[model samples]
Structure formats: structure tokens, C-alpha cells
Target: MITQLPDDFRFSGPSMELCTLTVRVADLADRFRFTLVHWGDQLGPATAMLVKLESGRDAALTEFRYAIERHGMKGPVVEVEAQDVAAVGVAALVDDVLGALRLSREDTDWIAPAENKARALDLLHWWAQTSWDDMHPRSEQRE
Candidate 1:
């Protein structure tokens, strides 16, 4: 499902030295979220890299993709060398994202009030998988 061109590619690597990150902040800077889509030598683990980082009691995960895609410019997609992020998990991962962006805690929120954590996580998982489904050319692919 990916094309390989010399330099005209939209995606590349399992980079041995860099991890590609996609990040977004939501709710007027009240929340922050990110995803580690690719890490050195591997794509993100099935359930480990999709956490949303936020600052207020809101559905940060719920709004993650929209915020990223809508608010994103040339800033959201970044490449981080592996040696920089020495740890992983929600806090570490978010911190890694913020660090990559050169953002500080004052610039972004790391926690938020979630109304329903379960629901928000569920929606996040759904979005992670289905976000691209709607963009598929259904009829063309059917053939």
C-alpha cells in the first residue's frame, strides 16, 4: 500500500536511527497528544504508541486525529533519532513528542480531566485504525 520513489515518497523507513512521530494538540492548547507511528527498525507496537497527552479534563484522545490533521502544518510530522527518547510510555512518549517539537510543559499540557477514560481510549483505538478507511477509493479497490 506504499509507493517507493527515490525521493517523492510520502512515507519511508523503519529508519534505523530515527522514529517518525505524528503529533497534535487539542482544545485550545488545553490538551496535547501524539503517536509514534514508526520507531527504529519497526512500526509502533500494536497498543503501545497511541496515547494522547492532554492538560485539562477533556476528551483529548477523542479529538486527537482531527486536531493533528486540521491544525498541522509542516510542524507535526517530525523525525527523532532513537538515542533521544530513552524511555517509553504515556508520559515518556508525550515528553518525547514535546521535546521533538521544542515545546515545554508550559507550552503544552501533559494531563487532563477525562470524563470517561474507557470511552476515550476506545474511540482513540477506533480512529487509529479507521481514520484512513474512509479515504479509500472503495469502488476502485473492489475491482
Candidate 2:
């Protein structure tokens, strides 16, 4: 599914304006692929995250979609805009991704430069592993 960010969804940050954010989900044989496209001049390149689960692909997709729907526009598309919004949509999505994969923050890698494609894939691999628990444990509670 693709969701277009509202034109009014503005936050102070990058010098470039955000044109659109395309979220694509594909169900593969063994895993589900999620691609987030930040389309704009200087917004950054697109990134893909792979998620593999023994079961509950539907549930994971549902939760992920919910996260995007709920907080996708609450913050900026990049980290530079973190100061303006108390809760970043990207951060929230990270939390949701971690929750869905049953992984901790330290367990996964993140896009450091905010536009690194390799690092983004690394992040996906680290978080895509199966967890021992069936339900997602909150990050705060994990510690």
C-alpha cells in the first residue's frame, strides 16, 4: 500500500521541501518487504526493510500500517527535524518495526547519514530476525 503525505504536513527541518513519501509493501515467499520512498529534491534516496516471521505476516503488516497511519506525519522525514516535533514519526516507525520483529534497538542498525541505503538494509536484517516471544515487548520494558 502507498500513502501520500499531505501537502500541509509541514515541519521545520531540511532546506529541501518534502514532496511525497511512498510506502510499498510486498509479500514474498519467506518474508515481507517494506520500501519507504522519500521522493523530493534532496529528501534522500529510497530505503527498503525486510521482515521475516514464522507466522503472523498479516498481523505485522496491520500493525505496521497502523503505525504509519497514526504517526507517519507527526514528525519530519529526517533526523534534522527532530527538534521541532517531540515525537518523530520515523522514531515511532522504528519502534513499531522493532516491536514487530521482537528486537531491541541495539540489535538493529540504523541509517546513520539518514540517506545510506546499505545501512538501511542492515537495519532491516537485524530487526527481521524472529524473536522467542509471540508478542512484541515494549523497548522500555525490555530493559
Candidate 3:
């Protein structure tokens, strides 16, 4: 349950300058979570991970992207970056990544065309207002 990253953010990106990749694999918690994130660089060559999918939200459609030889993970498109799909609006997350994509189905020709698309929508509206929780489903049913 450790997934943090706020330390006065300095994620300056657009061509290198990742700035966030905290990890702490020990079967559980201690802190330093975030699995992936390199959202800016490698925009044209396909490498914008931004991941965090650990069977959360019951999987299947929480942000999409598939390819990397359809399941090998090595260029050909692997821009997953998930964990957000409620009312459906990021082009319905780009038509579910063009229907289960499969190696560079051309996700908008590898986006980032205008100032990194306004800096990736201003960092997704500042991490959706600080990783919004709204009491995370009653705080996970009171844990």
C-alpha cells in the first residue's frame, strides 16, 4: 500500500529529467512505491510508462496500451500509464487503446506534438489534485 510521491515535486520532463521512480520491493510496505514513470522523454520512440497497475480497480481497462510485440515488452509501443477510468473521457482512454492494440497501432502517432501536449495536460491537472481519494471508497470499507 505504499505509493507516495509529493516531496515538492521537481518532475521536469520533455526530454530526460524523469524525477520519480520510488521503489521498495519486500513483499509489502515501507514506502517508496511508484512502479514506473518517465512520461516526457521517449515520447516519439515509445516508452512513456507511467504505470502502477497491481490488479487495482479490478483491472481490465484502467488506462490502456499493449504492444511490445503484443506482450513481450520491448518497443513497438508500451505507453500504458494507467489507473484512471471512471466516466470515460481521455478519448475514452483512446478507444481502449484502439481495441487491445498490438504493437504500435499508432497511438496518435506517438503524441507529444505541441509543447508535450501542454505538458501532458499540466501533469494531469497536478496529479488530479494531489492523488484525489475522496475517502477512497469509504477508505476501503474501513480496511
Candidate 4:
């Protein structure tokens, strides 16, 4: 399933079209935030958003809560180009979820490499519902 991704395929569109990585405001770039990612982004042959629960929900929850308490939050959604995502090493695809959300390298205690792709995908979905306007200035920047 990890070998079916078409070459040069970039993940675009909304959650309905493909999986999305929603990121909260704080942890979004490095505080309290979240992001969304598609399950089909894995080394697979799917073109839809994949929503799965991670076994380590406890850890992810704690991390998410900590961020909320420390940095405040917004929406749980973030648009990402994950169709080309992959787990090249032992670490699961979720390992990169933090990166995609903009979390710093120092705050990755919520996940470990000895993890699985499901974990990363799960995290992405959790934060997918987050608000991006509060964290990003895209609209303001454009003004």
C-alpha cells in the first residue's frame, strides 16, 4: 500500500478531496496548535482523507492539552500537501506531523520514532478542526 503513490502527485484540494493536516494556533508553529493530514498520503494508492485513531491517544492528548494551557488555540485545521509524504525511516509518518504543523524539534515528546504511521495521521486529523486565521496572517498579509 505504501508503494502506490503516483510520482509527482501533490496533495491539493480540501479534506473532502484528500486527507488534510489541520494545525491549531499554539502548537501550530511551536506552541498550542494542531494540523490535518490524509491517510492516503501514506505509501498507498488512495485519494481520500483518512481518519484513524492512534493507540497513543493519551500521549497526544496530553501534549495537545499542554499546548492549549500554555499558548492558547484556535481552529483545528491546516491545509497541507501530504500526498507525497512517506515514512522513509523507522519512524512513522506521524513523526512528521509536528513538523508540518510547525512544532519545534524540542517539543516532540508526544511522539517517538518507534511509532507508526497511524499515529501521525491521527494527530493531523485532531488538529484539522483548528482555526488558522488567529495564527496565520495570510489574509492580513494579502491586504
| The candidate that achieves the highest TM-score relative to the unseen native structure | 1
**lDDT digits (tens) for residues 1-143 of candidate 4:** 01122233343422211112333333332333223233333333222211222321111121133334454522232222322122232233444444333445354323333433444355445545444544666776779
TM-score-best of 2 and 4 = 4
| Model 3, span 1-143: residue lDDT tens | 21233323333321211111111121112223333332223322222223223322111111112433354432223232323332233344444433322212342334222243345555666666655654354555668
**How badly does each model clash, as a count of residue pairs?**
6, 0, 1, 35
Pick by lDDT: 1 or 3, better one: 1
TM-score of every model versus the real structure: 0.23, 0.21, 0.20, 0.22
Clashing pairs in 1: 32-53, 54-111, 55-111, 56-112, 56-113, 57-113
Flag regions of model 3 displaced more than 4 Å.
1-75, 80-111, 117-123, 136-143
| Model 3 TM-score relative to the real fold | 0.20
lDDT of 2 by residue, 1-143 (tens): 22223323432332111111222332221233334333323433333232332321211121133334665632122222232112333344444444554445564333233333334444444444434232666787688
Q: Candidate 1 residues 96-122, lDDT tens each?
A: 545534566555423322222333445
lDDT of 3: 0.30
| Model 3 / residue 68 / CA error / Å | 11
Task: Identify the runs in model 1 with alpha carbons over 4 angstroms from their true place.
Answer: 1-90, 109-117, 124-143
Q: Of models 2 and 4, which has the larger lDDT?
A: 2
RMSD of 1: 15.5
Between 1 and 3, whose TM-score is larger? 1
Global Cα RMSD, each model: 15.5, 17.6, 16.3, 18.0
